[model samples]
Target: MPSFWSQKSKCLYFYFSGMMTKHKKCFIVGAALIIITNIFTVCVVKLTQDSQSFCPYGWIGFQNKCYYFSKEEGDWNSSKYNCSTQHADLTIIDNTEEMNFLRRYKCSSDHWIGLKMAKNRTGQWVDGAIFTKSFGMRGSEGCAYLSDDGAATARCYTERKWICRKKIH
Candidate 1:
């Protein structure tokens, strides 16, 4: 009877040991899968971040914005129309670099920018932006200020070369 009990004990021990070995294998596999999945997720995130691209031809890239300079001379309304035709809007002056660039090639005259009179308020800029920087008024110059009004309003019908800016993938 004692011998029989010892034999049973050995069998139980062997069974338990086998079960533990299988569990260990399963745990190792699960841990490896978790590690692999984490690495894959990180790679995907980096790839997405690296996929950004600049705008196409005729669009100038500046400070995360693309600008298009129109060689054609037209009124503020027509200039905006032309820009819209090209899937862009009239250039909205936002900073000194943009202002200098525009002034540098000012089409021999003051061209109309995208700035416009606000429909809701007098002298309010309607371009859905607020100008926090001070680009003092080029008085009576009709141009729509991009991001908001720092540039003053001028006559709408004045013909001058213009710029257009757009955002695209």
Candidate 2:
């Protein structure tokens, strides 16, 4: 026959083992829930950030910038004035991607861009971008336009459609 102390020791060992198993299961479940919740939170935050970066209607969004192509034609000065009224400026092409975007969306007619002569008569953009001469800038008058073959210069008084651009807040 087993001694009373020996039976009590076996009962205590089995009781502790069963309790440990239950505790382990609860810990694993709690950890999994926490991980899942964190993943869901991260996904939601990314979605909201993407949506916030979107531009308003009628404006095209690209890399934190918004572009607007006008349907009306005007002189370069008048086009610039129009853009100012909209709290923007003539489109400034900073890279080939931006240039391509403008080219792809521009109307069949030429569109006035931001390039022009500075007060000192050197090439400059209204937004103060460095003029790198990516296009064949012709004419003594220095007002630039987005032509089918690339960028070209014409007199500021020439009538053309215009592009506007602004940074997305």
Q: In terms of lDDT, which candidate is strongest?
A: 2
lDDT of 1 at 107: 40
User: Could you give candidate 1's per-residue lDDT for residues 1-169 as a string of tens digits?
Assistant: 1121124232222234234222224455568889999999999988776555566675667767677766667877888789888878777776798777666644444455666654433343336666443476545443543213335565687676777777656
Stretches of model 2 off by over 4 angstroms after superposition: 1-52, 118-121
The C-alpha lDDT values of all candidates are 0.61, 0.80
Residue 32 displacement in candidate 2 (angstroms): 18
Question: Residue 28 in model 1: shift from native, Å?
Answer: 26
lDDT of 2 at 70: 90
Q: Quick one: best TM-score, which candidate? A: 2
TM-score of each: 0.53, 0.65
Clashing residue pairs, backbone N/CA/C < 3 A, model 2: none
Candidate 1, residue 126: how far the Cα is off, in Å: 5.2
Model 1 TM-score on a 0 to 1 scale: 0.53
